[model samples]
Target: MFKYLKNDIPASIVVFFVALPLCLGIALASDAPPLSGLIAGIIGGIVVGFFSGSRLGVSGPAAGLAAIVAAAIGTLGSFELFLSAVVLAGAIQIFFGVIRMGIIGYFFPNSVIKGMLSGIGIIIILKQIPHFFGYDSEPEGADSFIEKSGETTLSALAHITDNITLGSMIIGIVGIVIILFWDNILSKKHAFFKILQGSLVAVVVGTILQVVFSSNEALKIESLHLVQVPAPEKLSNFIDYLSFPDFSQIFSKDVVLIAFTLALVASLETLLSVEATDKLDPEKNVTPTNRELFAQGFGNIASGLIGGLPITQVIVRSSANIQSNAKSKLSAIIHGFLLLISVLTIPMLLNHIPKSVLAAILILVGYKLAKPSLFKKMFSLGWTQFVPFIVTILVIVFKDLLWGISIGLVIGIIVILVKSYQNSMFMKISEIDAGKTTKLVLAEEVTFLNKATIQKELFNLHENSSLELDIRKTRYLDYDVVEIIEDFLIQARNKNIHVHLLSERGNVDNPESFIEFLKLDKIKTNETN
Candidate 1:
């Protein structure tokens, strides 16, 4: 781990800056206290990092879990009660790990997985749109069909004018520009800025600007778009904010259901993130899924015990870690340590930082995830891959993330079933004597679904034509399909066409005997001629 210290340390600092705002944002989105997200992040990095088998997977307060947390809180009627569910979820995940259910992740098709990632990328960008434009009424990290503000997500886009914050917009643009410049220009020009990281620089600049603006009353900036942390004067006061779960609600069936939902959603999200992060690792390291689940379970339990938000392996922070050159578990470890130190020592410093700056960083993260090239590549891959990919993208963009993924999965399964059906049965014709004596061979194991196509081919035969259907290779024939074959044999006799049925276990000359011998219905194959 220390071998890459020169590169990894700098990367961890960058990731730390990137993670700081996300921790807060995800917590805010979940309707949990802002510090709860930070706490989760700190524990994610320290506890999960120490125990995780992943070389690059980063754990945090994931946006994907925001909906679960919010619904759980609303149902449980208290954030503390919801935390109990989180602990239960962690315990369940640990059980999943112990049972070695890691292989479940592979059951998802590659097409579906790609669609899922792309769909999620689109959702992240869409959900972050209001935040990027200085509108926060809809809640942070919301990617649901029905938003918390009682509007479909797109309708909220139209309502952005009503809740626009000028300070946030202005600072957001400035922050975005600073990040773009730093990433594209300044870092190339100066070593110090390169060392500091574009995100950190943008945060610093945003903080300085906030301070400068706050000093002047004429600027007229509200504190709503700024980070807020409870200032504690002493250790005891700080500890006062710590709360535990109200297990009194545990007896409620609703609470138990909510716990199950959290466990499933959190586990699935973490598994997907682990898959994605491993692909992004520079070293191409593979994370042990079961072990990662166990680590995440412990992290979530710790987070819940401390009034922190539910945690998962988050791709945004993981990607940031990769871009920041993080190596080994050390980067994650140091970043967690920094989280503890920063919240404990300089929360006021965090307050000075504008929300727009963080939004800018997230916008960058969003863009990275849903880059234009990804869309183009999907299109170029052809209809089978492209259709589901595009559908997933559009659905995610217009609908919700989960809905879009479900749609893509449905479409992908349809494609698979169609392909399988097409391959399940076939017909072979040998043209001889100018198609007069065509030999038609039926595929192995004919089913009812293949009847129509075969019937169509049979009807195309001319009067007095000869047709042979070889079913010796067929192990199982559906009753409906056998009936269709029997009906066709009668039609062939009437049309002056000769029909032949070849089966290893049946009488080939007597059609009815062939059917009876094959254990099919007592259908007549033909007059035993």
Candidate 2:
């Protein structure tokens, strides 16, 4: 891994810039101390990165889990109790890994996965809009439609005009321009531009602009609009920020329930991110799913012990790492060290950075995830794929992440059932000298659901016509469908219709009894066996 330091170091710097604000934002959204988010980021990067099978996945405090963390903390009645739950969650994840349960991730449909990424992208964009214009009333990482501030996403945007700050707006605009220039123009002109990430440049320029406007009352940005780092006067005071889990709460029923809930959600999110990051990896490296669970389990355990929020493999930072051309896990590890060093030594400098600048950086990430081309691509795949994809995006934008995914999965399953019902059998009708000859072909697997359609076709058959019942392609025929065919053959004789049965055993002309024929065929098959 150290062999790629030239690539890893630069990528780590970019990821560090990308992760810093996210750590604080997620912590704030969880209603935990901002330091807890930072702690989780450090452990996720350093501890989890050391053990993870993924070459490029970055782990941290996930925005997707913020609402759960907030609610659990409230219900548990103390942050320490919540920390205990997080530790138990980690243990549960380890159990999942040991039992080789990582295969569950593969069961999610592709449409749902794509929908998830796009939904998260749109959510990031919508949530960042207010921050871009200097409105910071809502927490930075809240992704729900109904915010803690009692304002809907659209209503928050509507109130942006009233809360706009001139300094923040100016810096925000400049930051975006700098980022656009760096990405579209400068990066294309020189390889050096790639090393100097657009996000880092935007943050620096925004910081300088903040200093420039500090003296002018009309143009000054408020403290609320800047990054808030807990500045300790001494090293001892810094240690005081860390909180440990209360082990006494381990047996509490509520705590145990929350722990299982966290384990399930965190495992799912981690697995999905693992799949996504593998797709984005330039080298197409396949991460070991069970090993990833082990990494996350221990990472969360360590984080909770240190009074940090629960940890998971986050797609946003992982995508950022891939886009930044990260070559190995070294980049992730280095970024964690950077987070630790900066928070311990240079938090005041970090505090000088404006939230609008970070918002500008995330807006670019959001646009990349929810590009217009992706929507058109999904639509072209047909309704079966597009319906679930679009619904996932809309629900994630209007509701929350987990709910949106669940709803999309249900829709996708429904689409599959509908298609199965329609394609259960293939029928063809041709005119003959005697009458119309109808050929009915059963699918590979015929179920009871096809009984109604088969019954309708049989009843509509012309009298004195020839009917061919083809079961050559069928492997498993349901009892209900078989009975339907048997009943149809009986009725066909009364109507003067000629019935022919086609099977692997060849043609049978006017069998005495369909059921007797099936019984004879089964006996012959058993003898062959």
Top model number, TM-score:
2
Per-residue error at 192 for model 2, in Å? Answer: 2.7
lDDT of 2 by residue, 259-351 (tens): 987887789889999988999998999999999999999999999998889999998789888888889999999999999998999889978
Which residue pairs in candidate 1 have backbone atoms (N, alpha carbon, C) closer than 3 angstroms, thus clashing?
Answer: 511-525, 512-525
lDDT of 1 by residue, 96-161 (tens): 889987776666555655665555555555655666666757643244556565666666677788
Shift in Å, residue 74, candidate 2: 7.4
Q: So what's the TM-score on candidate 1?
A: 0.77
Model 1 scores worst on lDDT over the 10 consecutive residues at: 520-529
